[model samples]
Structures are given as structure tokens and as C-alpha cells.
Target: MARIGVIGTGYVGLVTAVGMATLGHEVVGMDKDEGKIRKLKGGEPPFYEEGLEDYLKRAMEEGRLRFTLSTEEAVKGARYVFIAVNTPMDDDGSADLSQLLSASRSIARALDGFSILIVRSTAPVGSLDAMVEVMREEGKERGRDYELAYNPEFLREGTGIYDFLNPSRIVVGADTPEVAEEVMSLYEGINSPKLTTSIKNAQIIKYASNAFLAARVSFINEIAAVCEALGGDVWDVAEGIGLDPRIGRHYLRPGPGYSGPCLPKDLMALIRMSEEYGHFPHFLEAIHLRNEAQKRRVVWKVKEALGGVFTGKTVGVLGLTFKPNTDDVRNSISIPILRRMSKQGARVKAYDPMGGENAKAIFGDAVEVYNDPYEALDGVDAVLILTAWEEFAKLDWDRIRERVRRPYIVDSVGIFRRGAPEGWRAWTVGKGDLPSPEVSPESDV
Candidate 1:
């Protein structure tokens, strides 16, 4: 079994450490966060991901996994050191490599012998060069002291562990074919297509892949807007086009545009990276602008539904996370949408199965986050479904209708495919029917 050190125990690093341990490797995960390291040592995950706790427990029980606060202890004598630190988007739309470069410097000082340092973070194309420079300042030379490789991770947030264990494909880029092969050996038992290429290509593949997915999301949102105007069902349109072997159905479902830790940041980074290379990516820029517009469009739909006024309205929001099955609210679309509504004098109440606490922290005082979905929906002017969580679909619409002041819903994710409850006026994206005010119960007399 190979000894592996995974630096930065955030979502990617934690999942990688556990996944490597599960593969029978002796893995040590290191992070600077004392609290996070303490939690991991106690077998408590800092964040939620499906099946992560079980897998982490199993790996720890087998004595193949451990956590540490010392970078030197983690990387010393390891065969492979994976740098999975966060490369957050900077104000200038480029990747801020501060954390990554800091990790590399630490790893350089801690290395005992020749090891393969694999970068698992999503960064710009030339990020490896910056890492090499930093390591060189610490008196570590590449090819002699350690080998560098790019192995970008493509794990989704909610399904990160599963994605890591059962990846569709593995791409490893190194300076030499031999070095690439050695890095690929880390996943020996996994039966997936492994591609060995240059570092530049690997980085591009990572950026292009996310950019393409973001583009697909923006394209579908634009189509959804068109459908709303032309009275065409985008759901049907997406399916019909998706069936064409060239286009897949994934990322075609329209909602409040793509907003997550990776997609938006990566898309913006790519746009900036491309611009730095003297080529303006009009298509990518448009995709980004369209995503922003889609978020605004959701607010507009809510405003129009409320007779063009948000004053004194209590908007109940269902789903606050960027997606379901994860607690990550880093760049959720719900934040901006709700903030706009709250600023317009609307009282915002929201609920999510997992993201409530995080949303509460972000929206503090502006949004009332409830543990119970029903409580959030109680006595509201309108209900907006944002994240498309499965539980939202099975809600007691009858009870909701009774509690809500007006039976109006702006279903951005189209959770009510069967149509809203009787007497409810629902405005669904990409649907022809526009929501009309529900007639008061006394009007029936």
C-alpha cells in the first residue's frame, strides 16, 4: 500500500484522504484549522456529504486514515502528496492561489525524499509554475527533490465521495510519461479510463470542463426565459434537444442559474485567464452575464407576482443551498435573490434540509431560517422554490394553502411538475402560464 498525504482537509482534501484510505492506502490529512482538525480526529466531519461519515468511520476503523495539524508530519515520507487546498476566486476574476502556494511551501520544507506532489485543486493553467517557484525559494528543486503533476478533481459537492471512488475518468498530467503512470497507479483498483498528458492540457481540461457545464446551464436558462415569453415548455425543449446524441440531458434543467463553489468561480477564472492570453471569450462572458440576469429574473418574477411590490410581503423561500444534499452555501444563488427582496422591504423566511444554519449565518437578521419547512412557509405572501430538493416536492400542499396568506408560488426549479395545488396560482419558469392573484375566499360568496 502506498503512503499518501492529503493537504488541506476541506471538501476536496477530506474526500480525497478518505477515498485514498478506503483504497487501502495509509492516508494522513493535514489542515491548519485547529477546530477542523480536532473535529476530524474525533470522527466528526466539518461539512456534510452523503455517505461521508460512514466512509470516514470505516477508513479510521481500519487504521488507514488519520488527521493532523502539522504539515511536516503529514507529508514526511509519503509516496504521494496531494495538494487539495482551496483556490478561491479573486476580486479580479482570477484564482487566488495564496492558500495553494502556502501549502506548496510547507510541503517543500517537509519533504524527506523524492515524492510525487499531485495538485488536485482547480487552478489556472500556469499555477504549477507558481508552485514550483515557491518550492524553489524553500531550496527544493523539481526533478531531483520531488516530481510535480496535475490531477484536477471533478467531484461534485453532494456526491463527492461517490464521485471520487467511482470517477468516470482519471486525468493525470506530468512532465514525463513515467511520472504520470506512477501517479495513475494511486487508483490501481478503480476501473476507469485514465488519461496521461501534459500539465497544461490537464489544467485546461479542468477549466474547460467546468466552463462548458456552466455554459450549458446558462444556455438552458436563456431558453427557459424564451419559453416563458413564447409559451413553449423548456422542459420538453431541453429533452428533445438532449436526445440528440451530441447533447446530453445533464445541466439542461433550468433554474436560478448555476451557482456553486466551483462552476461560477471556475467560469469566471477561465474568462479572466482567456482575457489575459489576449483572446476575449465573448461566449464565456455572455454565459456569466446570463447567469446573473437569471437570478435577477427570479426576483422580477416574484415582484411581478406580488403586484410589482415587495413592501410588507413575507416571502417564504424553499431551499437555500446552491443544490440539494449538501450544506455548502458558498456561492448560492438564493443569497443574492433573497438579499434583493429583503432590501426591498420584504421579510424573507427560508428553510433547507441541510443549509439552514449556513444560510442563517449569511442572511442574519435579514432572513429568518427555520429548521422546519412548514414554519418557513407559514403565513407568507408567496413561496419560492430555489434549490429543487426532493423533499420540497412531497410537501403537504393542502396544509400550505391553509397557512399561506396567498396561495401563490414562484417555482424556479419546477418542483411542481404535476402543477400546484388546487386554488394556488404558481408561476413556474419556462412555463406558459403566468401566475394570477388567488381570489379571496370571501369573493366566492
Candidate 2:
């Protein structure tokens, strides 16, 4: 197996480090945070991701995984050093490459010779080329050229481990095809097809992939709004369109628009990159606008259900995370919707299965965060579901109907059924109206 060094112990870094080690590679994950390194060395994952801790522990037990704060120690004698640092966008929308450049400079300082430095961070198109320039500049000063490559990660936080092990394709980009071949050899155990390209194409591929998915989500969400207006079911519409062999279905669920670390940021970065090159990515721009509009659509739905105003309305929101089974709330669509509701004089009560703590940091005292989903509905005027956690699908809506002051529901994620309750008013995306339920005395309370 390849001897690997992973820099920057964030989600991607941690997963990549541990996963490579689990695949029998000798891995040393380096970070400047001593506390994080200490925690990881003791078998504690710095964040919550399903199965990451288990795999980390297994790798640690197998003596293949190691953590260090010193880059010198981590990269010494390692044949492959994977740079997995964050490349968050700046105020100008251009990628703030400071973190990446810092990590590259540090890796450069520690390089001995003939080691492949792989950039695995999601970066703007041409970013890999810029990074190669930095590496060659540093190498020139040190009188040695370090081999460089790029392997963009397509990992989703909640299902990161599964995605890594069963990736759809493995991409490796480099200065030359031979460098990509060397990089591909590192994943000998992986059965996925490999795509090799130049540095510029590799960087663009990552952004293009995310931007296309964002477009798909926004396109469907926009259609869902149209369907709602026309009394048509968007689910049926999307499924019908998705069945086309050319369009194959995935990411067509119309809900609170796509929000996570990747899509929004990558789209903005791509836009910024396009502006730099004197071109306008009109479709990507439209996608971004549509996503923001989707968030506002939730607010409009709330206002409609609450009689055209949120003044004095008690609104209960279910699901706070950007999506299901993930605690990450960066740019989560729920945050903006909550802020807008609260600003309009609505009392917001929210319950998320796992994102409460992160939500608390964002909302502060503006909204009441309930530990129990049912408790969040206490005396609320209407309930809105944002994230599509499976628990929401099976909720005792009969009990929730009894607790709320107003029998109104807005099912943005399709959590409520039609013909469920008398006096029950609900709006669902991509689906028909929620049915009123058969009322029973015991079930009502």
C-alpha cells in the first residue's frame, strides 16, 4: 500500500487519513491544532460522522494510523502527501487560498525528494495550476522539484466513509500523465474507474460536478414551486423527467434548497472564477438565485399559512441541519428562513435530531430550540419541516396536531400526508396536499 501523509485534519482530511490507513497504508495525519491531534491519537474523532470513529479506531489499533502536529514528522519519508485543507471563499468571492498556500509552503519545506504532493481539496478551476506554481517556486528555492498531483474529494459528510470506499470514479490530475499513473497506482485496491487529466481540468471537474448538482436541485425546486401553483405534483413530474435514460434520477428531491459546505460555496467560487475570465456563468447564476428564492419560498409559505403575516404567530420548525444525519450548518437554508420569520415577529421553535447545538450557535436566543421534536410543536401556530430526517416522515402527526394552537402545516420535505385531519392546512413540495386524518379521541392528545 502507499505510504501517505494527510495535512489539515478537517472532515475530509480525517476521513482520507483514516481511510487510507484502513486500506493498509501507513498514514500520518498532520495538523497545527495540538488538541485535535491529541484527541485523534487517543481514538476520538474531532467531529461527528457515521462510521468515521469506528474506522479511525480500527486503523489506530492496526498501528497503521498516526497523528502529529509537526509537518516535519508527518511528511518525512512519506511517498504521498495529501493536502486536504479548506479553501473557503473570501469577501470578493475568489477562493481564499491562504490556508491551502500555507499548507503547501509547509509541505514544501518538509519535502525530501520525489514525493507526490496531492491536492485533494475542492478548489476553483485553475487553482491546481496555481498550487503547482507555488510548489515549483518553493522547490526551486530548495534546489529540488517535488512531484505534484491533484485528486479532488467527492465525499459527503454524513456518508463520507461509504462514498470513499465505493466511489463512482477515482480522478487523478497531474503535470504529466505519468504522474497521474503513479497517483492511480496508490488506489490499487479500489475497483472504481479512474479518470486522469491535467491539473486545470481536474480542478474544473470538481467545481463542475458540484455546480451541476446544484443546478439540478434548484431546477427541480423551481419546478416544484410551479407545480404547487398549477396544482400538479412535482414528485410525479420529477420522476417522469428522471426516468429518461439521459437524465437518470438523483438529487431531484425538492426541498429547502441545496445547502452544505460544498454546493453554494463552489457555485459562488465558479462564478467568481468566470468573472475573472470575463465570462458570465448564466445558468450557475440562475441556480444560485433560485436557491435563495427557495429559502424565501418557505417564508412565503409560512406567511400564507399564518394568514399573510407572521406577527404574533408561533411557528414550529422541524429539522435544522442543512440536510439529514449531518450536524454541519454552514450556509444551511434553515438559518435564513428562521431569521426572516423571527424578524417578522414570529416565535420560532425548532427541533433537529442532531443539529441543535450548531443551530444554537447561529440562532442564539432568537428561537427556542427544543430537544424533543414533539415539544417544539407546543402551542405553535404552524409546523414547517425543513430537513428530511426519516424520523420526521413517521412522526405522530395526530399528537402534534393536538399540541399546536393552529392546525396548519407546511411540509417542505414531504413529511405530512393528505386527508389527515379536519382544520388541518398543509403545503408540501413535490407532492399532493396532505390528507385530513381520521380523528380519534385518544389519538388526538
Candidate 3:
């Protein structure tokens, strides 16, 4: 087993560090945050990832995993140093490599000998092209040399551990086939397919993959609008197309547009990266524009469902986070919806299964945080399901119907039943299941 050093202690870094350790490699994780290192040293995971804590504790107990606040200590004697830092998006939506470059410089300065530096962070195309120059500069200053490779991660949150353990394919991009093979050997035990390509291809693949998924989401949302107009269901339409082997079935589920850290930022990065080479990404540009419009569409639906009354109404927001089983609220659609509704003089109450803390930070006093989903629904005029948490699907709809002042349900995720409650109004996106609102003469009488 190769000795591994991991930089950054965020979701990706922690998971990669512990996961490699679990594979029986001697791994050291380095982060400048002393508090986080202390927590990790105590066998506690720094963030919430299902089943990650158990593996972390097991790896530590097996003496295969270690944590330190010093990058020098972590990189010393490490054969493979994984740079898993963040490449956050800047104001203009370009991938900001400030954090990544800083980490690479530190790793390079602390290099003891001929160690392979792996760029595991999600970066723009040709991002690692400059890594050799930067690291060479640092290495010359420190009288040493280091090999570099680009290895982007595709692990999704919540299911990150499983994805890492059982990845579909491993891609390694390097300056030489020898370095690429060296990076590939780190996954020796895993029996998955491996692809070794130029560093540029590996870098572009991550952005291309995320942009395609974002496009699919935006495409479906746009179709859902037409579906709503023509009395059609988007789910059925998408499913029909997804059944084709060429299309396959994945990321076709519709919801409050794509968000949560990756897709939105990656699309922008891809656009900028492509433009740098004098190539315009028209399709990606359309995807980004479509997603923004889709967010506005959600607000329009709420207003339409409310029958044009916005003032003095109680709106219950279910699912505050970007998605379920995650607390990350980066660019969550719920924030914008709540902001819009609040501007319309509507009092909004919100709840999420796991995103409350993050939502609280974003929403502040703009929204009332509820521990129970029913509490958010209590006495509200209308209920909107923004995220498709499994619990939201099985909500005591009868109880919710009784609690809400007006039994109106606007389901963006199509999690609620269409006609479950009498005298209740409900609408869902992209579903042919919901018939038009039926009005009875007795209702007016």
C-alpha cells in the first residue's frame, strides 16, 4: 500500500482520506483548521456523510489513518499526496484556482523527495497544465522534484462512501504514462475499469459530465412547463425517453432545478474554460439560462396556485436544503423562493430533514425554522414541497390537509398524491396524474 497524504478536510477530502485508509493504506490528512483536526483525531467525522464515521473510526483503530494540522508533517514520506482542495466559483462564475494553487504550493514546498502529487479537486480544463510550472518553481526553490497528475473525483454527497468504494471507472491524467500508471495503482484492489488519458481530457470530463446533467434537468424543467400547459406529465415523457438504451436511466428525476455546490458552478466554469480557448459553449450557456428561468417558474407557480393573493398569506416551505440527505444549501432554490415570497408580504415557515442548520444560516429571521414538517404546515395558507425528501412523500397528508388554512399543495417534486384530500387543491410539475382543479357548485354555495 502506498503512503497517502490528503489536503483539505471538507466533505471530499475527509471521505477520500478515510476511504483510502480503509483500503489499508497509511493515510495522513492535513488541514490548517486545528479544531477540525482535533475532532478528526478523536475519531469523529468533521461533517455528515452516511456511514463515514464508522469507517473513519475503524481506519483510525487499525492505525492506517492519521490527522494533522501541519501540511509538512502530512506530506513527509508520503508517496501520493492528494490535493483535494476546493476550486470555488468567482463572481464572474469562473473557477477560482486560488485555493488550489495555494495548496499545491504548500505541498510542493514541503516535498521531501520524489513524491507523486495528485490533483483530486474538481477543476477547469487545462487547470493542471500550470501545476508543473508552479510546482517546479517551488521545488527548485526547495531543492527537490515532484511528479504531478490530475485525478478528478465523481463521488456524490450522502452516497459518497459507497461511490468511492465501488466507483464505475477510475480516470487518471498525467504528463507521462508512467505517472498515470502510478496513480492508477493506488486503486489496485478495486476491480473497476480504469482510463488513463491526457490531463486535459480528465479535467474536461468532470465539467462535461456535470454540465450534461444540468442540461438534462433544465431541459426537463422547460418540458415540464409545456407539460403543465398541455395537460401532460413530464415524468412520463422523460421516462419514455429514458428507457432507450442510448439514453439510459440516471439523473432524470425532476425537482427544484439543479443546485447543491456542483452543477451550477461547473457549468459556468466550463463556459469560461471553453471561451478561454476561443470556443463558445452555446448548449452550456442555454442550460445555465434555462435553470435560472426555471427558478422563476417555481415562484410563478406559487403565485398562480395562490389565485393571485400574496399579502397576509401563510406559506409553508417544505425542504429548505438544495436536496435531501444533505445539509449543504449552496445555491439552493428554496432560498430564492423564500426571499421572493417574503418580499410579497407572505410569512414563510420552512423545515428540512437535515438542512436546518445551514438553512437557518441563510434564511435568518426571514423564515421560521420548524423541527417538524407538520409544524411548518400548521395554519399555513399553502404548502410547497421544494425538495423530495422520502418523508415528505409519506407525509400525513390528511393531517397536513387539516392543518393548513387553505388545503392548497404545490409540489415541485411531484411527491404528493393528486386527489388524496377532499376540497384540497394540489399541483405537481411534469406529471399527467394531476387533473385540472375540479370545482363544485356546493363549494361556492
Best by lDDT: 1
| TM-score of each model, paired residue for residue | 0.97, 0.92, 0.94
- Tens digit of per-residue lDDT, candidate 2, span 91-148: 9867888899889878878887667888898877766556667777775331245677
Q: Rate the local accuracy (lDDT) of all candidates.
A: 0.91, 0.84, 0.83
Q: By TM-score, is 2 or 3 better? A: 3
Better of 1 and 3 by TM-score: 1
Candidate 3: list runs displaced more than 4 Å: 136-144, 417-423, 432-445
Residues 224-289 of candidate 3: C-alpha lDDT, one tens digit per residue: 878777878777787897899998768777777888888899999999988989999898899999
Clashes of 3: 2
lDDT of candidate model 2 versus the reference: 0.84
Per-residue lDDT of 23 in model 1: 91
What candidate 2 gets wrong by more than 4 Å, as runs, is: 132-143, 417-423, 431-445
Sort the predicted structures by TM-score, highest score first: 1, 3, 2
